[model samples]
Target: MPRKVLVAYGTKNGSTAQIAQIVAEVLSKAGLTAEALPARSVTSVSSYDAVVVGSGLYAGRWHKDARRFVRRHRRSLAPRPIWLFSSGPLDASASERDIPPVPGVRRVMDNLEVTEHVTFGGCLEEGAEGRIARMIVRSGKGGDFRDFTAIEAWAAHIAEELAGPESR
Candidate 1:
């Protein structure tokens, strides 16, 4: 049976959710059973063999839901293979270079046995919520900076790690 992987994310404007979906798709294509869901919607992590948790970076902190999810499920999550991701850089900096996890995320990593963590570029389109998001969009600084190629590659690496050498 294929390993069941859950890709859970906390997103305010939906871009981070899109990234998580891409991750799940890549894992599924790599022969694992993967599902992506909003982090707040997940009631339990015990059913998944591995978990990928991601959150939108806001003010250098993870979204509240992501933080709560981790704290709520820490016990169930600690023994499982885990990966993490953050999406929120309004520029090409993320694609051009590695962006370390924000401090809050780093603390979470320190508490958990995270196998890997990645930061991807963010997206802010016309319909984004919040005053600052609207202001950024109006100023034309908000656009999609997500590198799908890089996102896919990262997910594939996770799959290969979870699926064993035979998967390669």
Candidate 2:
């Protein structure tokens, strides 16, 4: 049987949520069963074969709900194939390697033993953009800077990895 991958995320506005949906769509196109759902909509992960968690970064940390979800489900998630991502570092020419990890990500990295962790350039928009975006825009750093190709490639890689022998 094919594995069921859950792509869940927390977003202040909707950028991060949109990213998660894109990831799920890419993964599904690769022949996997993938669902992109908001963090709050996910109750029990018992049926998932793997998990992809994402959140927007603010104040040098992930959104509070993202952290809380991970903390609440750590034990249940530890044994699975888990991946993490943070949306941060507003519109810029910064390289992927240059995108800094959110503050609490260090502990999450250590604790979850996450299979993968990535950072994407954040977008700055008003009329509902979160605190982080407001700050970045106010500081003259807000813009849409995400690389869709890189994002799709990474999702494909995850799908390939999940199709391997061990994931079964």
Candidate 2 residue pairs in clash (backbone atoms < 3 Å): none
TM-score per model over all chains: 0.96, 0.89
- Per-residue CA lDDT of model 1 for 1-168, tens digit only, reads 339999999999999999999999999998899999999999999889899999999889999999999999999989888899999999999999989999999898999968889999999999999999999999999999999999999999998888775321
Model 2 lDDT on a 0 to 1 scale = 0.81
lDDT of 2 by residue, 52-121 (tens): 9999887778887788888888888898888888886775543447564666987887898888888888
Consecutive 10-residue window with the lowest summed lDDT within model 2? 91-100
Candidate 1: segments with Cα more than 4 A from true spot: 165-168
Best by lDDT: 1
Clashes of each: 0, 0
